[model samples]
Target chain A: MELLVFLIFAFLAVAAALVVVAHKNPVYSTMALVFTLFSVAVLFILLGAPFIGVLQVLIYTGAIVVLFLFVIMLLNIGREDSQIAGHKAQLFFALLGAVSFGSLVILALSSLRPKVLAPLTPELVSLKALASTLFNEFLLPFEIIGLLLTVAVIGATVAARRPTAEESAATAAERSIETKEARP
Target chain B: MNVDVVVTVAKIAVVLGLLLQVAPIMVWVERRGSAMMQDRPGPNRLGPFGLFQALADAVKFLFKEDVTPAAADKPLYLMAPALALLPAFTTSVVIPWGPNFTWDGKEYAFTVSNADTGVLLFLALASLGVYSLVMAGYASNNKFSLLGSIRASAQLISYELAMTVAVLAVIIPVGSFHLTDVVAYQRTNTWNCLLQPFGFLVFCIAAFAETNRLPFDLPEAESELVAGFHTEYSAMRFAAFFQAEYTSMAALSALGCTLFLGGWSLPWLNYEGMGWLGVALGLGTLLAKVGVCMFVFVWVRWTFPRFRYDQLMRLGWKFLLPVALLNLIAVSAMTLAGWL
Candidate 1:
C-alpha cells in the first residue's frame, strides 16, 4: 500500500513539474509548480520525514513560489511576454537545462543503495523521535538555520531595494532644475 | 483491510464534511460580528437571526454565473478558483481536531491526516493557497487583477517567513513539530500563549496577514484595487475565492488552537491520567480552544481598519520578522543557559 501511494505521489510530482516547464503562461507554470511542491510534500511523508515534507510545502510552495509570482505580477510581464521563448539561443539553453537536470537526477537515482529502510511504524516515527533528533544531536545545525534565515531576509531586502524608474526620473528632474538655477 | 485504514478514511470524510459546513458559518459569523461591532444589525432578515445565512450564501454562490473575460486565457481562468480552493480544503487535514481513544477494544486517533509533522503539514497546505490568487490574477489579463495578485503574493510571502519562524519558536521549547504533541505540551504546562507570548503574537499577526485579512488585506482593497485578483472573476468562480479565504481563516484558527491553546485539551484538567475522564476532558478542551480562536479572528477583523499596502509590507518585514528572529535567539540562549 505504501509503495502504491509512493508511486502515485511520485507520478504526480513529476507530471506537475513537467507542466511547470511546458506551459506557455507564466501564471499557469507557477500554479503547476505549486502542485509539484505539494506532491513532493506527500512523498516526504511517505519517506518518514513528515516534518521536512510539510516544511517543503509551507516554505517553498507558500513562500518562495509566492515571491516568484509576486515578482512576475509586479513587473507586469503579461501573457504575451510570458509565452515560450522564441529565440533559437533560448531554446538551446532550455534543452541544455533539461538535459543537465535529467542527468543529475539519473545519477542520484543510480547511486541509491539497494538496502531497504526499516518499515515506518507509527510509534517509531512519532513527533517525539523527530524532536529528539532535531534538538539533541542536530543542535548546531538548528542554531545555524536561525542565522541563515537572518541572512536570507537581509538578501531579499537588498534585492527588492533597487530604485524604480520613477525615483530615478524625479532625481534627474531635480538635478536638471538645480543646474539651470546655478548657471543663471 | 485493517482498522487503521478504515479509521483514516473515515477521518478524511469527517474533515471534508466539517470544512463544508464550517466555512459558510464562518462567513455568517464574520458578517454578524462585524455588524455588531460597528453598531448595526447583521443578517437578521435571513433565518433565525441569520443562522441560515450561510445556506442562503451557498445557494446564491452556486447559482451565480461562472464568468470569463473575453480576452482572458479561458482554460487557466477557469482553473484558478479550483486551484485556490483545493489547497485550502487540504489544509484542514493536519489539524488534530479531537483526541485519540480506545473504544470497543480498538485504538483510534482523531485527526484528518496523522503525519508526524502535524503543524508543519498545516503550514505547507496553507502556503499553497497563494497559487489560486496568483493564477486567477494572471489569467484574467486585467490590470486590477494583476495588481491584486502582486499584493497578495508579496504580502503572503513576507508574512510567511515571520509565521514560520514564530512556529519554530513554539516548536523548539515543546521539542516537537506534531500538532498533537504541541497540544500535549500546552496541556501539561500553561498554554503556549502564556509560555511563549512573543511567539504567540507573531503567529497571530502573521496568520491574519497570511490569510489576507484586514488590516493586512491589501490584495483586494476595493477602495483602490477594485476587488484585486478576483476583479475579473464572477459568479461561482468568485465564490470559490470567497470560500477559500474563510476556509483558510478557519484552518489558521485550528492551527492556533493546536500550537498555543492546546489541541483537544480542556483548561484546568489534571495532567496525570484519570481514566476515561481525562480523554473526554482533552477532547472538550481542544474544541473550546479552537472555538475561542475562531471568535477572536472575527473580532479582530471587525476591530481594525485595513492597512496601507506599503505599511502592511513594512510591518511584516520591519517589525514581525525582527521580533521572530529575536525570539528564536532568546529561546536558544535560554536553552543554552538551562533556563527553559
Candidate 2:
C-alpha cells in the first residue's frame, strides 16, 4: 500500500512538473507547478518525516506558489507571455531535464539498499533536532547560510534600486526635453 | 510477550494496521470542537451526543453518487483525494504513543514506525500531499476551483519554511532528530514549550497554516474560493479531504505534544514507573497533552481573523522565518553555555 501510494504521488509530481514547463497558459503552468510541489511533499511524508512533510506543504505550497501567483497577477503576464518562449528551445530543455532527472532516478533506484550510513535513532526530527544538527554538526554550513541570507538581502536592494533609478532618470530627461521644446 | 511476536504483530497492525482508524476519530473531535466553539449544535441530532455523526456522515458519503463532470480529467480526478489523504494517514507511523512494555517477561517498545529519519520522511510526504489539491483543482477545470487550489498551494508552501525552521529550533538543543530522544530530553526537566517558547509559538502558528485551519484557511475560504480546490468534489472524495485535514491536525498535535509537552511524561511522576499503572499513566498523559493542543487548534481557529493572502505570505517569509532562525541561534548559544 505504501509503495503504491508513493509511486502514484511520484508519477503525479514528475508528470505535473513536466506539464508545468510544457503548458501554453502561464496560469495553467503555475497551477501545474503547485501540483508538482505538493506531490513531492507527499513523498516526503511517506518517508516518515511528517515534520518535513508539513514544512514542504507550508513552505512550497503555501508561500512559494503564492509568490508565483502574486507575480503572475501583478505582471498580468497572460497567455501571450507564456507562449513567447520558443517551443524548440523548450523541447530541448525538456529533453535535457528528462535525461538528467531520469539518470538521477536510475542511480537512486540502483542503490535502493545502500549501506545505512548513520545509525537509526528513534527521534521525532522536530525543531530541536534540526537546531542541534545545524548548529553542532553542520555549524559551518549554518554560518554560511547566514552569510547567504545577508548577500541575498543586499543583492535584492541593489537590484531593485538600479532598475527604478534608471527608469526614473529616463522619465525625467524626457520631461525636460518636452519643457525645452515648449519654451523655444 | 516475546520480542519476535511483538515485532511481527506491531509491524503489521501498528505500522500500517488498525491504528490507522484513529485518524477518523480525529475528524469527529474537530467537528464537535468547531461546532461547540461557534455556539451551535453541529451533528448531535444524528446520534447520541453526535458521537456517531462521523459514521453516519461516512455512510452518506459512501452511498452518494460519484459525480465525474464532463470536463474533468477522470483518472487524475479520481486519484486526487487518495493522493491528498495517503500522506496524511502515513505521517503518524513514527509517533511514539507510549514507552516500551515488558509484558510477561519480554520487552516490546511502543511505537508505530521507528525510522531514524522519520521527521524528514514526514516532511516529504506532506509536501507531496499538496499535489492532490492542485490536481483536483486543475482537473476540475473550473475557475473557482483552480483559483482556490492555487491559493491553497501557495499558502501551504509559504508557511512550511517557518514550520521547518521552528522544528529546527527545537532540534538544535537536543542534538538528535529522534522523537524518542526529544521526548526523553523533555522528560528529564522542562517541556520544550517552557524552554523554547519562541519556537513553540512559531510551530503552533505554522501548524495552523500547514493544516490550512481558519486564520490561515485561505484555501477553503468559502467566502472566496467556493469550497476552494475541492469545490466540485462530492461524496467520499470531499470527505477524504476533510479527513486528511483533521488527521493532519491530529498528527501535528501528537508531534507537538511529544516535542514540547514531553511526550507521555507527567510532571508528578518520575521515569521509573514500569507496570500497567505506568502504561496507563503514560498513555493518559499523552492523550491529555494532545487533547489540549487540539483544543488550542480549535480555539485559535475561532479567535483570530483569517490573514489576507499577502499578509499571510509576508508573515511567514518576513517575520516567522527570521524569528525562527534567530531563536535557533539563541538556543544554540544557550545550550553551549549550559543554561538549558
TM-score of each: 0.83, 0.74
Scoring only the A-chain of each prediction against the true A-chain gives TM-scores of 0.65, 0.68
Lowest lDDT block of 10, candidate 2 chain B:
B14-23
User: How well does candidate 1 reproduce the true complex, by DockQ?
Assistant: 0.65
- Highest lDDT among the candidates is held by which one? 1
Candidate 2 yields a Cα-based lDDT of: 0.76
Cα deviation of A39 in candidate 2 (Å)? Answer: 12
Docking class of 2: incorrect
lDDT of 2 by residue, B197-228 (tens): 99998988888998888898887888888888
| The best candidate in terms of DockQ | 1
